[model samples]
Target chain A: MKRKPSIVVVASSGGHLTQAMCATSLVKRDLVLVSNKNMLDGSHFTRVYTIRDTQYNVLIHAVNFFVALKILLKERPRAMFSTGGPICLPFALAAKITRTRFVFLDTMSRVTELSNSGKIIKKYGLYDSFLCQWEAVANDSGAEYHGQAFDLGDHGHQ
Target chain B: MVKPLILVTMGTNDYPFTRLYNAIKNDSLYTDNRCEWFIQTGSCEAPVAPACGVIEKIIPRADMEDLIRRSALVISHCGIGTLNLMLKYRKRVIFVPRVAAHDEFSDDHQLQIAREIKNQRMKVVFPDDQFPLLDYEQIKEDNKLSDPVDITNYDLAEIINQKLTG
Candidate 1:
């Protein structure tokens, strides 16, 4: 029996999470989501885990690392996708050790310099593909442009 | 007759323009009791003077749409979130980019966004090193100079959808 590839989507709250959700709709595989914010309400996930919001404090990062390690062992996802933030750190590190494919999408906010998170993950060489919203960011980061970068769009009243 | 209200948002990220808050708190421009100021701070600790003639309220993560709907002018940081919200709402806006040297961020990318907005002839403000005190009336008048470019979310959705499906 051919097993469907397992996929894990991870991001911080707000824009990153929103961007990841956009990608989730197109993925037709076993899916899991991990985030630091309670932004996920009524989300479709095989499992959902909340990690400490890493906007402040390093202790949260240490805790999330262990949590990610445990999740990696249990699900053994084939690929990991992230929109760049502290929450993606643990998963990126775990993917490196497990030899799983890791994809990093630099947020649209950075048109020139790599985001702080992007810079940190760049050294790992674990990222199989680095996706960027702007061509300049891809050129500057030395990552192959994945193309078709999306901006969050004009704010529409819900 | 009531004056049109002006909404000011600095977004969730704290910028180094704390001085702007202090400058407008007790300014004579707001003393006329004609112009109303609706300001949202990124932090609860933002030092705000008591309401003199204009109303001041501290809203933590308030709805951007509500703020824009009730406002005639929007003063905001050069962040994309705020910029997109203003454009989405079709409100006349003035943007002030935070300087990187002031520790606003690790880089000065906001300046790049600001330049892009300027190239489009959108209303934007880039403070000189001196952080010159701005006249509210002048800022309000400058907003009428340009027509905002229509940047829609449909394009964004289509692009992401293609990437994910492809």
Candidate 2:
């Protein structure tokens, strides 16, 4: 049997996961989710890997780095993507070290600026492609803006 | 016949959103048995349960989706997940963004996103603003709605797809 290459998506459970799913809806490659919480029902991703979630915890990030490396080694994905809530920080580091193409989409929740994890990844030059959902935010940060993950326009109340 | 359902979600983050819970408790509809309420409180504690409904910490994603489908109006934290669902289902929504001042979240990102919200069906209640009184007529009106069009921005998804696959 042959193993298919996958695109590993990193995001937290709430809005980050929603944006990631919306943003990656067009991807034809096998989608594998690397989320901090396993809230998903496996309807979307080929596989789901849970990792310790953190924004400011240094030790957890360090541990998740190895977990990321292990998953990358096993999957050897075609690329990596994230709509971050800081849980993707270690995965970003691992993607750079493993030479996997990494695309980071700043979460739509941060309307005014890049998210904290996005700022860290951007500052460290860890991503292959960077995008922001907000046009003004993208303009300010130099990230690609291709509109939001979903339409905010009302559809006349169902 | 089932009563009109109101779903209140505070997201899955570990913040205690007592402010939202308190506001709902103080509302006139809190003790109304004609309507049903399911409040997913996350870490927020509810000392006084609703007279007619229940409060829970968290629920499965599928359960939440079902609740959203049945809900006439959704009182939600300004989390994008709930916003996406409300928009997808075209539910009447009251968005109360979690603010940093009250330790509802680590930062004011929810408020930031709340300000950018321009959806006619959705209303954003700022920290200074009071949670609007639950409107029974609108809830009953919304309960009649059926399916809504899918609103995912595939244009953005296509760009993202190209960035990853190209």
Candidate 3:
């Protein structure tokens, strides 16, 4: 049987992964995750690939770049998405190299600016569609604005 | 009567948030027996045990979710993940942003996100601010079990979906 094409998601373990999950919640395609930590109980993705976590470390990024190449070639995702920490750097590079449609959401944590990884991605034109959760950041960086992964207002209190 | 659960999550970041650990450790409730504590310290060292609860470096995400559902109060780093979970469970939370000045995180972005938390159920503790006293009475009142509500912004998700599948 032929397998469905998947979307490869690259995010770090905590906030980035959370935002990635919420931002991708409506996606119906098979989802494959590339993250630094395996915190989940196996509920969210069709497959989870663990990669070394880093922050502008050239050596580690070098190692992860090849790993990213291998994963993308094997999974051959229809598209790729990320909410980032520096770990997403290699995957972003890989997605660009593979001609995968890459959509990136700069993490909601960065209220005033894009993350370091997001900055590099933007500067290098690594993404096909780049978005920011904060409108201010989007305006400053010329990235698309989509409210946020979840509501952060007073509307839901009991 | 069962002791109300107080949950502390320092997030899954590699950074060690000993400031948060010390803050909770110094709280009068840390040694009190009125309620129990469950702390997920992540990369932080578990130097000692609490008088009334368990301390683990980290637990699986499912375990964390179950704990959130049963928790009376949550003290967490201002990671978007913990914030999202608390919102889904509608849990009362005290959020402490991890600051780069203190080496609690890589940057001051947590503080930025902390500013966006307008939820009545959530409280933000700035670097200079005190970690508010844990109210046993308030905790006891809030101890009822709950199920998580779907809190994802489907409108945003729908937009993301369009951009990706297109």
Candidate 4:
């Protein structure tokens, strides 16, 4: 049997997590999800890991980084996907070191400026493919704009 | 007198009105007796009310859907959830983007969403811009406005399936 590509979806709580979940419906492979405490529940993931809600602190970030490394080691995911925020940082680094494909889907917001998370990812150039919601943002950030994957016109309940 | 209930939400994270709450309260626009204003403070500290026509209600996140449904008009921050709810319910929305200058966030995604709303011909309010606070009659007029897009017709699962598998 052909081996399926393993994927890990990472994000912070709330909108970023929601956007990640919405995007994950497209992947047809083994998946593991990691997010902050707030998004741990009411999610569809075979394996879920919760991290502390640390927006921008080095101490909290270091802990999350190690935790992510541990998870990545155990899961052996072929690709990592994240919407944005601090949680994605460690995984993106691990993906680079492990030669795993890191796909950073810039969250769909803020047309004028790149998100802080997007800026960090761009600075490190860790993303194998940086997906964006709008072409203008992608062009400005020098990332690949995949356009909005979410069917915003669709209001059907999930 | 029966007054139309105006629902205002500034989203889950961004609270641009936190500092401006006091300024708004003192303004005659909010203090004038015309309609009842019901504001939802997602996670921010509640604003002190000025003696006027406004009534503040701090709603938990769980109650957002119910309140949106019952409201005659929704004045909300430019968040995906807020936009989705307004689109889904086909409700009249006067959206205001949260600005970074207000310490809302490090970036300005809300402003982008607001721009998109305006492009769609939907009613929206920009932050730092003056707005004639909607009265009961205006709220009704706003609801009668049509949104250019019908979000219900598109299939989200199909889109996701195509993107992931192909």
Please name the candidate that would achieve the greatest TM-score relative to the true structure.
3
For model 2, what is the error of residue A157's alpha carbon versus the real structure, in angstroms, after optimal superposition? 2.7
Model 1 CAPRI rating: incorrect
The clash number for model 2 is 0
Model 4: per-residue Cα lDDT over B66-87, one tens digit each = 6666666777667776676676
Candidate 1: chain B TM-score against the reference chain B: 0.70
State which docking tier applies to candidate 3. Answer: medium
Worst 10 residues of 2 chain B by lDDT: B140-149
lDDT of 2 by residue, A83-156 (tens): 99888988999999999999999988898889888899999999999988889989999998889999988776
Question: Which scores greater on TM-score, model 3 or model 4?
Answer: 3
User: Model 1, range B1-166, lDDT digits (tens) per residue?
Assistant: 4455666766544344564465455556545455666776654244544343233333422344565666666767777656655654556666777667766654677787677663232456566634334465754543332233435334444444344334
For residue A96, model 3's alpha carbon misses the true position, in angstroms, by: 1.3
List CA RMSD, all candidates. Answer: 5.8, 1.4, 1.3, 5.4
TM-score of predicted chain B versus true chain B for each candidate: 0.70, 0.93, 0.95, 0.69
Candidate 1: deviation at residue A7, Å?
Answer: 6.4
- Per-residue accuracy of model 4 over A1-158 as CA lDDT, tens digit each: 97665678887755676577667765677768787744343436777788775667888788877887888888887678888777788778877877777778787765666778788888989887777777788888887765564545534321
| Candidate 4 backbone collisions, by pair | A26-B164, A110-B109, A153-B151, A155-B151
What's model 2's overall lDDT? 0.88
Better of 1 and 4 by DockQ: 4
| lDDT tens per residue, model 2, B1-166 | 6788988999999899999999999988889887889999988988888878888998878788889888888899999888888888888889999999999999999998888787778889999987788887788777754465688899989988888888
Top-lDDT structure, candidate number: 3
i-RMS for every candidate (Å) is 6.2, 1.5, 1.5, 5.9
Model 1: residues with Cα > 4 Å off, grouped in runs: A1-9, A13-50, A53-58, A70-79, A97-101, A146-158, B1-3, B14-16, B26-32, B49-62, B119-121, B129-166
Largest DockQ belongs to which candidate?
Answer: 2
